[model samples]
Target: MFIFFGLFADPVSDVLLRISEAWPDLKVVRLEHPISAIAARFGENHYDLSRDKIPTDILLMTERLSSETPSARFLLLRTECFGGICDNRGRILLDGRTLFEAEGDGALRRLIKFWGADIGPEEIFEPLGRSFRWG
Candidate 1:
């Protein structure tokens, strides 16, 4: 049970959706709020924490995905923009130092791939990929 916590970004949900699609047993949840539209599609778990702070035992959280990628972060934009995953407690699971570094490295590498920098995949993937983990 991973809790998607943050300012309620799209990428977060998008990635969780993908993970859920890949792993059905994985419980992806978010706070239920009026702002949430995915509640209809995914379930009624979508909510605004500020409005209703229902606490639950959370496992993990993913920080908000940035638009730093060349086009858009596949994990953040395409995936999160739809519906996000969250835990019953709402403790965000995506705020590890490694994950932050990985997002930065991945973003930079993605930009370099478009001729913005002269770095190698090893340099980029090492940090970015290092941040992500499977539970």
Candidate 2:
């Protein structure tokens, strides 16, 4: 399960789209403001966000998600900038542990590839000719 906070920049958004395409069953939730509009799911667990209040602290948010989806793995991505280093920098957390402190889109792509390797398809074959092979 992947939970995203804030608006995703173009590069990050593209990577996310690729990931979803590669792993069709992966659950992804983008949490946006007003807080009430976001609906999230992880594996068999589903959440209704209409009445829920989101925590401002990252740790607390992590805890909340962990509790909601106990057995599922989680990746939290957010766009955050500090100390005037706001060059599309983002933070990534894997299972409540900081995977990348402050990194750009390239780092995110690598992280996704690494974590998604086993779960996603080993090979993606594009169409070669008029006849396409399924499987």
Among all candidates shown, the one with the greatest lDDT: 2
What is the alpha-carbon RMSD of candidate 1 to the true structure?
15.9
Kindly report which residue stretches of model 2 are placed more than 4 angstroms away from their true locations once superposed.
1-59, 79-96, 99-102, 117-135
lDDT by residue for model 2 (64-110), tens: 44344333333443322344332223343444444454346444444
Task: Report per-prediction Cα RMSD to one decimal.
Answer: 15.9, 14.9
Model 1 residue 106 CA deviation in Å: 37
Our tally of clashes for model 1 stands at 28
In terms of TM-score, the best-performing candidate is 2
Clash totals, every prediction = 28, 0
